[model samples]
Target chain A: MDSLNSLIDGFGTALTPVNLLWAALGVLLGTAIGVLPGIGPAMAVALLLPVTYGLEPTGAFIMFAGIYYGAMFGGSTTSILLNTPGESAAVVAAMEGHPMAKAGRGPQALAAAAIGHFAGGMIGTVLLVVLAPTVASLAVDIGAPDYFAIMVLAFIAVTSVLGSSRIRGLASLLIGLTIGLVGLDQMTGQQRLTFGSLQLADGVDVVIVAVGLFAIGEALWVAAHLRRSTGEPIPVGRPWLGRDDLRRTWKSWLRGPVIGFPFGAIPAGGAEIPTFLSYVTEKRLSKHREEFGKGAIEGVAGPESAASASAAGTLVSMLTLGLPTTAVAAVMLAAFQQYGIQPGPLLFEREPELVWGLIASLFVGMVLLLALNLPLAPLWAKLLRIPRPYLYAGILFFAAVGAYAVGGEAADLVILLVIGLIGLGMRRYGLPVLPAVIGVILGPAAEQQLRRALQISDGSASGLVDTPFSVTVYGVVLLILAWPLVRKQVTRRMAARR
Target chain B: MTTGTAGPTPGPKRAHWLRDHSELGVSVLLLVLGVLVLTDALTMSVDLTQRGPVGPRTVPLVVGGGLLVIAVLLAADVLRGGRGEAEGGEDIDLAEPADWRTVLLLAGVFLANAVLIGPFGFPVSGALLFWGSAWALGSRHYDRDPLIAAGLSLVTYFVFDSLLGVPLPGGPLMGVV
Candidate 1:
């Protein structure tokens, strides 16, 4: 009931004519950018960060919420039509959705996805409203040692739990920490790796790091292997569901958010797991199970909603815990920090209007996204027909401008180029990009908590593990580390049984 | 398709295998970066008052040490036939050989943008960045691309500087627009 009242008040702020317009415009821009081949929600938000610079913090965050939902919707559209997902979360949707496109049911797939996004988005946002305050209140009891332990847990989870190789992920994360170390040390005001440059003191801006990695690296990679021709783009019509399609999809719409929100609310629980789980569950239960590989509506419907719910779930953790489980969330966290606003347990209490307003806008953003994109689906497909050369050139062009515009220093462009090169190298070497991003954002904060924990203990290391919360978190971290070796042994025992 | 089987290509393929070992480049990079971090940490002069048991140097030492271990482990993995697969995306074609010339050209364009943005301001240099990048990416519309690039730069300049009040420098045209 308290959450309901706050949400109603939030609507008062979000529904202002100006804020409403920004939400619509963000959805429009996010969809346009998200339709591009390689751009993800993270890149879309990073590139568009400059647009909201002129606004007040509340309105700016409202626009960001809009962009987040829009990117997910746009990514689903592309996956269905082109079999090219802008991010990993949408990869499952493409497996069935693309086959539908090939079979010329492109419009139906889009319809299902848009509706699923709308449905999951609604359910997830409601849960977020109801649950975030409770979580934040629970989080208020957390001390520095527990905070440090949680950050370490986040670091271990992102590196070890998600990626193909833990070593490569850890290496990427360490490199990001090194980059984060370049500026002044937060506690002591000492320079760690400045190399004695005045510009180095301020540190590499997160926008520069993000745009450099996702935009510039992607452009360079594509330029090196530019495919002269492309797959025949499926022509899409207005996305509208028939009676049969609705009957097939309504249950999935409910089930998806139910599966997605829980995973998203936890640290290191990325959308991919719940989304895949949704799809597999749907496959096993559907009467049309045979229709799945051949373009079943349930495959598109289930995963699309699951992914959106997962996106909402990530925000719950982001708003309350300051833990970013996805690349998009990490970038959003950086954006919050840029405005000198810390997002954590204190955030809701500190800025209730902004918090509730941002959450309210998610609901508003979903309605606007579905209403706008359904009829405009064909136009977004037309965006994909944009030639490769112009598209990439524009990416580099904006990246340079955004990098330069942030600090108005030519030095930033240099930093941008260098990070872009590093990003290229990371991609070439198969390093997972998420851990590095998480490291850069969380690196300084982790150091702060570590030192503070020790300070309270008068330099005793046991302070780090004194709390039960810390012990439990560390135990989980150790379990994650040892799981692969344990898994091999378990499998061998099973083989012996066989 | 014809070029694929054009000759007894012990050529690009074998050279690729030999160059495959060049992945040690990443290990070398990690080693160099680790050494740099450690050297910086070790040489730091700290005010004694600022010294906690864990000071500024502590995180760097841990980070640097981690980098070294990972570097050595990665090299061993490479020797034992572990390879990090190059990332694939919608636009990426891993089968195609990397066109280094295009990449180098793009980097040169960016560096030029960095250098020129200071003197020439955003409009002139931004146009150069867009146009140069387009050219590097193989857009040969020399007749029309320059006009579009210039247009884009001016529009963004007006929007960001005039409307948004970001205070972008206009260089020689400082007073004109």
Candidate 2:
């Protein structure tokens, strides 16, 4: 009842004419940029983040709610129509959705995806509402050791689970941690890696790091291998689900959120796994098993819903625990910091209205996204027709503006370009960007927590495992670390026996 | 993922392991960075007044050590013929060789913007960035590109500076706007 009452008040804040207007603008802008061939949700958010610094935090977050879902839908639309997913999460949608587009069932596939996004977002938001407060309250009592353990768990999970090479992920993560270590030590004010430069004293801004890696780095990478030919999205009519389509998709829409929410709530629970899992789950349960890879509407419905639902699940961790499990969530965490808001257990207690209003705005944003996208799906697709040169140039332009806007010094822009090159190197070598991002955001926090724990123990490392929660988390980290080796051994043994 | 499996296949044709495994450069960079971090941490002048058992240097030592270890492991992997698959996207044509010319051109433009933003202000510099990048990316509409770049730069300036109140240096136009 308490949560319900708070949610209703949140609606009161979100339903205002001005707030609704900003939400609509966020959706429009997010989808417009997000629909471009190469831009993903994270880039879309980063691109738009600089300009929104003018707005109040509540309004800005509400707008971000719209922008977040709008970017996701835009990425999905591009994937379905052009087989061009901006990032890995949308790969599942392209698996079946693109095939459907090629088969001239583009409208139906889009309908299923739109509805699926809506259903999953709705259900997941509901779950976030019900579960966030309870989690927050529980997290409030968690001590430094437990917190440190959780951050360590997150570090290992992101490094090990993502990308093809664990070593590469770790390297990227260490690079980010080093960047995090660049600033003066929070406790003692001693510089660790400033290299005697006064500018380096404050360390790199998260906004600059984010913009550099995702936007500038991405633009340069695209520039390095620019193609002559342009990719076009398949032309589509209005998206609508027929009776049979509705019946086939309803269960999947419901099931998708169920599978995705939990995965997204966990550290390094990226959208790829849940979407793929939902796709596999749907295939196993489907009466149209043969159609799983061949443009099945159920395939589109399941994974799209799963992806959207997983996005909400990511919020559960971000809003409650302040640990970002995905790239976009990491950028969103940086955004929270920019707004002078620290998202954690006390966030709800400190800013009840902002938290609840953000949740309610998510619900509002979902409805707005579905309403706008269904009728204007074709319009969004036309964004692909934009010339690639102008598109990438625009990204760089905005990245500069955003980077400069952070501190208004040319220094940030310089840092952006330099880090951007490193980002390019990472992409060239198959280093996943998420671990690097997570490391930059979490490294300092982890160090601080570690220090606090050790201080409490008066230098005994045993304090790290004194808590039951810390012990369990460490156990999970050990399992994650050992799982790959065990799997490799098992596979080798099986091959040898064969 | 790539299947160019970097194991020692014992083929004379691929005997130039160092040349063939160019990705070793990444590990080299990692190594250099590791050394930098370790040296910095070891040399850090921590104050005696520091309270915690773990000072700021402790985390850097661990992170620096991890980086060095990863560098060695990655180098070994590359030597064994393991390759890190380059990322791909819709616009990228991986089959084609990297066009370093364009990348350098874009970087030059970016660097110019950074240098010029202080002297000429955001309007002139940001416009130059847009136009230069478009040209580098193969946009040939010279007549219209500048107009668009200028318009875009001005709009951004107005949005961030005028509307949002971010203090972008206006240079000569400081008094006019």
Candidate 3:
């Protein structure tokens, strides 16, 4: 009932004419940028971060919420039409959706995707409204030790779970930490690695890091291997669903949010797991199992819903715990920080209007996305036809401008170029970029929590495990660290016995 | 593609050996970075009163030590025949030898933007950056591209500076902007 009241009030704020316009504009621009290849939601958010510099925080965040959902919708459109996924979460969609498109059911596949995203987004936002307050209330009681433990959990999950190689992930994380350490120390007023540059005093901006690593580096890497052409986009008529498709998809839509919501709520939140799980579950349960590989409507419906649901779910952690589970969420965190807003337990209590308004905007964005995308997907597909050279060159231009816009310092551009080089190296080496991003964002917070916990315990190391919650969290982290080794040993022993 | 293959033909056995151990280059880089971190941490000046129990030095030291351990482990893994697969996530083809010519050209474009932004302002330099990058990426529309690039830079400058009021430097165009 309390959540309902807050949501109603949130709607009152989000539905205002100006905020609605922002929401619509956000959806429009988000879908446009998200349609382009090599640019994901994270890059979209990072690139546009400078544009929202003038808006009030509430309006800006509402626009951001729109963009977030808009990117997910746009990614599916590309996956279906171009067979090039804009976001990793949309990879599953492309698998079945692309096949469906190839079979001359492109419109049906697209409709299922947009509708699935709408259903999943609505359900996910509802789940968020019901659960966020309770979660925030619980999180408010957690001490520094538990906070530190949770960050450790996040670090472990990002490094080990997202990428194939743990070593590369850890190395990437270390690099991020090094970058994070370049600024002045929070606890002590001492410089660590500034090397006497005045620009280094304020530390490297997260925007600079994000734009450099994602935008400039990606452009350089792609330019090196630029595919001359990305073939013609599969043409589609207006999206329409048949009776059989409707009958098959409705249940999967209901089931997807249920599977996806919890994955996003966890600290290790990512859409990949739930989407894969939803795809496998739909494959196993669908009556039309024969169409599983060759483009099943259920495959499109289930995973798209799961992906959007998990995106909404990620907000649970970002808002309540101030932990970012994905690169997009991390950039959103940077946005919040830019506004002098800390998005955690205090955000809900201190600024319920802002928090709830942002949440409410998610709902509004979804309806707008479906309305805009269904009729305009072909227009969005036209973005794919953009010449590769101009597209990448424009990306570099924006990246340089975005970096330089921060404090209008030429030094920022230098930093961007260096970081862009590092990003190129990481991509070449197959290092997962997310860990570095997470490490840069979360490293300082973890350090603060660690220092605070130690200070409270008068420098006792065991204070980190003083509470049951912290102990359990650390135990989980340890198990995550040890699981591969233990499994390997067990497999070897079983083989020897055989 | 013929020119992009790794250096003039070596014996098959030697080529395989080099291919397997190529990752050691990365491990060596990591080791060097670890050493640098440790050296910097050791030389960091700390006021006596500012030294809390953990202090600023602690995290860096730990990070440096962890990097060393990771480098050793990575080296061992490579020796044990572990391999890293090239990413297939994007439209990129990692099997193709990097076009260093293009990469270097793009880098020069960025450097040119950095050097020029101060004198020419964002519009002029930004146009150059855009055009240079496009050229590096193999767009040879020398006639049409500059017009497009200048248009993009001018619109971008006006939008950000006038409508948005973000205060980009005007440089020589200061009066016009």
Candidate 4:
């Protein structure tokens, strides 16, 4: 009942004209960029961060939230229609959606995807509204050691689970941590790796790193692989959903949110695991399991819903615990810090209007997204028909403009190129980029927490592991780090038996 | 894993051992980089505070240690012949040469932006950038490319400069715009 009242209050803030406009703009821009081959919400939000400097916090965040969910929706359109996944979460969608497109049931796939997005997003948001306060209350009891342990767990889980190879993932994470160390050391106020440059005083901006890596690096990599090629164009099918299609897909849509929400809330658990799990679950449970690789509607619906739901779930964690489960969430956390607002357990109690208003706007944004996606999907599809050259060129242009917009520093452009090359190399070597981004965002905060925990316990080494709660958190981290080795041995014995 | 009848499975002969252990090579390189970073970090003079057990070096040291452990583990895995292939589920085609045109074009775009951004400002430099990228991406329609490029540059100019209030570089041709 308390949640119901506050949700109505949230609606009041979300429905204001200015907030609505911000939401619309975010979704529009999100969809536009999301259709592009390499750009994702993380890059989009990074590009927009400097621009959002002037807007009210609530309005800016409303737009950022819209972009996050909007990209998840838009990413599926490309996956189904063109077999090109603009984001990692959409990779599963592409697997099944493309086959469906080839079978001339692309419209049915699109309908399932759109409906799934709505269902998943709504359910994820509902969980956020209900579960966030409870989680936050628990968080308030956490001390510096506990927080440090949690971060360590997050670092381990994210790098190991997100990619095909855990080694490559850790390497990627190390690179990010190194980059995070580039600025002035926070504790001593001394430069660690600035190389004595005056611009090194403030350290590299998170926006520049994100834009360079995602937008510029992506462009450079694509350019390196560019080829004159063509394929049998997949035609856009009818846009309307048949009643039978709806009946078939609704159950999957409902199930997707339930699966995705918990994954989103867990630290280091991201959309990829939930999406893959959703696909496997749907395949095992479906009455028409045979239809899975042959344009199954459930295949398209379940994963797409789970992906969006997980995205919403990540937002809940970010706003409440100040923890980011994904790359985009990390960047947004940086954005929040830039505004001088440290998001934690007390945020809702401190700024109820901002939190609730943001929640309300998500509901409104989801509605607008469905309207934009369902009827105008062809327009979105036409984005692919545009020459790749023009699209990529536009990305480079924006990259330079975005870099220069922040203080008009020419050196930032140079940094962008350098980082772009680094990004390209990482991609070529199969390294995940998210961990590095995490390191950059959380490095200083982690240092501060470690110092605080130590100060409380004197100079003793045992001080680091003194608290019961902290010890438990570290115990969990150790298990996560060790699980891979255990799993490998088990798998080897199983294979030997086979 | 279904071993499809593509070929004789190469008799499990471990075709191209170097390719299989590429990730191992990468892990070694990362370990070296981590060592280099640690050396650099250690070179800095630290002013210790008496107030706390953990100092400024604690976080970096921990991260560096984690990197070393992970890298060594990865190298061991690679050395043990535990690494998988590219997982294409298909036979490899080795005859294709790398695409160099895109490499040159992307480099050109970055160079042009860096050089021109200060002198010509955001609009003109951005226009060139847009047009060049479009050309690089394989747009053959010359008639439409420049117009689209200029239009995109201008729209970006307005959004960043007017709407967002970001002060984009206006190079030597600043007043002309």
Considering every candidate listed, which one attains the maximal lDDT? Answer: 2
Which 10-residue span in candidate 2 chain A carries the lowest summed lDDT? A46-55
Candidate 4 yields a Cα-based lDDT of 0.77
For residues A402-493, could you state the per-residue lDDT of candidate 2 as single tens digits? 88888888888889999999999889888888788888888888999999999999999998999887898899999999999999999999
lDDT of 1: 0.85
Candidate 2 lDDT over residue span B25-55, tens digit each: 9999999999999999888777784787888
- Which regions of candidate 1 fall more than 4 Å away from where they truly are? A51-53, A267-269, B1-18, B47-49
Q: Write the per-residue lDDT of candidate 4 for residues B118-153, one digit (tens) a residue.
A: 878877888888888777667777898888877887
Report the lDDT tens digits of candidate 3 across residue range B1-177. 113467556558776667657878778888998888888788887766354467888898998898899889889988998766545545576666668789899999899989898988888899999999999988999899999999999888888888877878777886674
DockQ category of candidate 1: medium
Q: Interface RMSD in Å per candidate, to 1 decimal?
A: 1.4, 1.2, 1.7, 4.4
Candidates 3 and 4 compared: the better one by DockQ is 3
The residue pairs found clashing in candidate 2 are B6-B80, B6-B81, B6-B82
- Model 4: fnat (fraction of native contacts): 0.56
- What is model 2's interface RMSD? 1.2
Q: In candidate 4, how many Å is residue A102 off?
A: 3.4
Model 3 CA lDDT for position A54: 69
Model 3: per-residue lDDT, tens digit, A214-286?
8877887787777755667898887889998899999998889998888877755388889889999999999
